[model samples]
Target: MAVDMKTIEHLCSLSKLSYDEEGMEKVMGEMGSIIDLMDEIKSFDLAYDDTKDGNEIRFADTREDVPEESFPTEKLLANAENTDGCYVVPKVVE
Candidate 1:
């Protein structure tokens, strides 16, 4: 799979980002390397036990769900800019 300039441009357009010529080249190189790494990974045959009564085995170390005590609402919201039992922050955009 090739990582081409068209793909990079499309990604940047969707992300609302711009890059200078030099920066674009650098980003292109990094993206190409990441694609190559992904291709290499795709070609590997990972080892996994597939013979468990003809079904794949699952993890058995999961613990039971148990709720625990947590900090009070007042203490939890202490560092917030403003709160009245609900967190609030300065709006940065319209």
Candidate 2:
């Protein structure tokens, strides 16, 4: 698959991005390479054993979840300059 100027322009517009001629050419080349890689990946024959449960096979090495003690709320909020029940921060935007 080839990435043409029209496709690049459309993608740029959709992403709210702008590029110069040189930048566009570079992007087009990179996008073509990515498409070629995807095509190559699609041609691979990926197989999995159906006899075993897929989730059990995939997660066999993972550790079990365990609960632990948490920090006191007062200690967590102690350093705040302005807090009501939580840490206070300055309003960022209008």
Candidate 3:
């Protein structure tokens, strides 16, 4: 697909952007290059084995969730700068 001035103008209008002739030309060139790259990528013959089992398509090894002991509330609150039985943080909103 060719990136033309009309298309650039339309895109700029939609984005509420104002570009000079030189900037428009630069953007058009970049867009054209991107489109050409996409076309090249689209023409590639990517083949994958479809006979593989669904269970064998694991990207990472899964681990079982094991319950562990946790620290007491008093122990956790001991590290807080200011706590009224809970953590104290700065007021975020008015």
Best by TM-score: 1
Candidate 1 weakest lDDT stretch, 10 residues: 50-59
Global lDDT for candidate 3? 0.86
Per model, state how many residue pairs clash. 0, 0, 0
Better of 1 and 3 by lDDT: 3
What shift in Å separates residue 14 of candidate 2 from its native position after superposition?
Answer: 1.1
**Which segments of model 3 are wrong by more than 4 Å?**
41-94
**Candidate 3 lDDT, tens digit per residue, 60-90?**
6766578887899989999888999888997
lDDT of 1 at 44: 71
In the range 1-94, model 1's lDDT, one tens digit per residue, is 5678899999999999989999999999999998888887776787666564565445575666799888998998998888978998777996
Output the better candidate (1/3) by TM-score.
1
Q: lDDT ranking from best to worst?
A: 2, 3, 1
Please report how far candidate 3 places residue 65 from its true position, in Å.
30
Write one digit per residue (lDDT tens) for candidate 2, span 2-93.
99999999999999998999999999999999988889877679766676655555575777788888999889899889889988898899
* Model 3 worst lDDT window (10 residues): 53-62
